[model samples]
Target: MKLLILGGTEFVGRAVVEAALGRGWEVTVFHRGRHAPPAGVRSLHGDRTTGPEGLAALATGSWDAVVDTWSGAPSAVRDAARLLADRVGRYAYVSSRSVYSWPPAAGLAEDGPLVEGSPDAGDVPYAESKMGGELAATAAFGAERTLHVRAGLIIGPYENIGRLPWWLGRVARGGTVLAPGPRSLPLQYVDARDLAEWTLDAVAAGLSGPYNLVSPPGHTTMGELLDACVRVTGADVELRWAEPEAVLAAGLEPWSELPVWLPPGEMYDAMHTADVSRAVAAGLRCRPVEETVADTWAWLESIGGVAPRRPDRPEVGLSPEREADFLAKYDPAGGDR
Candidate 1:
């Protein structure tokens, strides 16, 4: 199979390229030279933000599939899809559940309403841009030829987003780690490799439509996830469970600074609780959480930490000072640890 992947050198895109290579598919990656393409894949350099001339290199070749991981402007996505409509058999756009309206309720189905409208390539909002990408793909390739892989928080190796890495790093640090509670808080995420393999298989099988690509709900809890982190990293640590309200009261932000954590009774509680039965039935198998944790920890150790890679400023994950202050005060009501 001849596959074309846009932005195939980072996180989720990298996983897809690797998975496709393992399957012995002919993969060509079209991306800006910000990063090198994987060793074996053919690389074409171009900026998606540029107009016709930017995409001119891709105009000549045909591909069996195109997997787009674009998170910016709908116009760019529309132009690309329009260009590739006749050149590719399938267009798989990696969209996020954020494309759905916020405060998603429990048991939200894939058929639920999606965000609408186009966005400027510059000054693009993440959610609206994704929604625009979906529309662009469908509009150009038509429903029969497009697949929208709507994913939730993607985890596993090479994840630079700092969600899983932050957890793994914090847990590996040992001693009085403040964990978000209740400990049973359900979390859902899919390994990037799993999503890639499933997406490829679906394309090959002529499967089309939106699939909520996340691990099945209740597959693991926050506590179980942390335990896996500790086991994989061999941390001689004790996790001090902090109630969500308490953590919030202590001035800790949910999801951003905490990474992969959400407070109870918050509207975002439903973000991680999305229904993913369709993807599972369609052969989306997830590896063990421990495996994901272990491999990710190994990658972190090899890189020597996130700071070097993100030198300008590490965006996600809490600061040591902030964590120390929160840990120093044990009681949610403001007592000492």
Candidate 2:
């Protein structure tokens, strides 16, 4: 098999590249060259945001399949899909579950209504951008040849989004860590490597259309996840598990300040309870959360204990001052340790 990946130098894209290589497939990475792709694949340098001319390097080659992980503008996806429609045999767009309409109900599946988007749109919000990218891919490749990987909460090595890395780093600090409670609160996420492997298999099997790509709900709970982190990092921290009400009332934000945490409510239900039956039935197997956490810590240590941050995304996790203040004011387990 031969594969071409756009933006193949980091995060999910990098995972796809590595997974393809591990399968003994020939791989080509079309990227901006800001970071180096893995050693084995062919590299083509271009900036898709610069429009058509910047894509000159991509004009000459063809691949059995092309995986695009563009998240910024829909027009970029449109342009690339159009350019490669004839040359590439299959198109796989790494789309997000965020394309679902606002306040997606718990257990929403691939058939859920999507947000509005157009192939020609530019500089839109993340949800619309992904929706438009999906539209653009199918528009160019036809539904039979296009695969939409509607991924939710991707976390693993080479993660530039800073979710798991923040937890690992915070745990390494070894103090009273603000662990969100109702410890059994489940989470839905996919290890990028797992997502990559499944995508390659799906494309090879001629699978098309949107698949809600995530682990089954309750693959791991909040406590299990954090406990793994503490175990891996060998932190001597006390997990001050605070209730959702107390955490929110203390002016902390979910997802942003607290990273992977979402308070129990509509957002949590929407995010952590997606129906991934389609993906699971289609050969999606997630690694244990402990493995994910441990490997991520190992990777972080290799990279000097600091994870790279995407310029496009805002930084996550609570500041030391804010966390200290919150811990000082309210400890659900009683006064203070």
Candidate 3:
């Protein structure tokens, strides 16, 4: 099978490319050519943001499946779908859980109400635009010919985005690490390789429509997540529960620049937990979190994926009283304590 991937150089895309190649599928990638293509993979380069040049490059050939890990903007995806609708047998768009509405209630299903037109959604147009892209792709190729993979917090090897790595690095240092307060927070992440492998399998099975690709059952909560990280890194780090605001004031950023922090908010709440029965039923088998954590750390060590050092400024340790006060104000429920 000839599989063409859009945006095949970065974390998730690279994983998909690797998975596809491992399955002995003929894979071709289309990107801006800024980064080097994976060794021995066919590549065509052009900008997707500007015009039809990139679409033109892809117009020349046909494939059994086109997995688009990039192109979240509605217009770009719409155009690409129009261009390749007749050529490709299946179109898979990698979307995010962000497409769901905030404060997702328990057991949010694949057919749950999605976020409508919101300007703020365009801030990270990729996630926001994906909602529209899903509609457009489904409309163009029919629901049976398109697959929308709404992935959760993707964590695994070669994750340079500093989401999981920040926590891992801080914990490995064996220092007082700041963490979110409790709320029985549901945390779910899919290993990139697993996601990639599932995408390939879905294509092969001619699977279509939307599916939430997330961690399996009993794979929720922040404490378990931290424990897994500790086991992987062999770090005995002490965690200091602090207010989200205090952490921000201390120069920490949210995993993603979303509006909410505590559980049951926007981003976290939507993915605090998601039912993955459909994906599993479709042959999606994720690696154990322990294995994921260990593999991620091993990859980071090999690539020196340490957080860059900030300029040494005057130490600004929070006083015990002040820290306690901040924790009280923010973590009033005291779940993370």
Query: Which stretches of candidate 2 lie above 4 Å from their native place?
Result: 333-337
* Full candidate order by lDDT, most accurate first: 2, 1, 3
Query: What lDDT, from 0 to 1, does candidate 3 have?
Result: 0.72
Taken over the whole model, the C-alpha lDDT of each candidate is 0.85, 0.93, 0.72
User: Per-residue CA lDDT of candidate 1, range 192-304, in tens?
Assistant: 99999999999998888899999887878889899899898888998888887678878888888988888656455567778888888999899988888888888889888
TM-score of each: 0.94, 0.98, 0.81
Q: After aligning candidate 1 to the native by TM-score, how far in Å is the CA of 122 from where it should be?
A: 4.9
The segments of candidate 1 whose C-alpha lies over 4 angstroms from its true place after superposition are 119-122, 307-314, 332-337
Model 1 — which ten-residue stretch has the worst lDDT?
A: 305-314
lDDT tens digits, residue span 1-337, model 2: 9899998899999999999999999999999989999999999999999998889999897789999999988999999999999999999999999999989999999999889999999999999999999999999999999999999999999999999999999999999998988799899999999999999999899999999998998799999999999999999999988998888888899999998889888999778889999999999999999999999999999999999999889999999999999888985666534
- TM-score for candidate 1, please give it: 0.94
Q: If the candidates were sorted by their TM-score against the true structure, best first, what order would they fall in?
A: 2, 1, 3
Clashes of each: 0, 0, 2
Question: What lDDT is reached at residue 63 by model 3?
Answer: 93
Candidate 1 clashing pairs, residues 3+ apart or interchain:
none
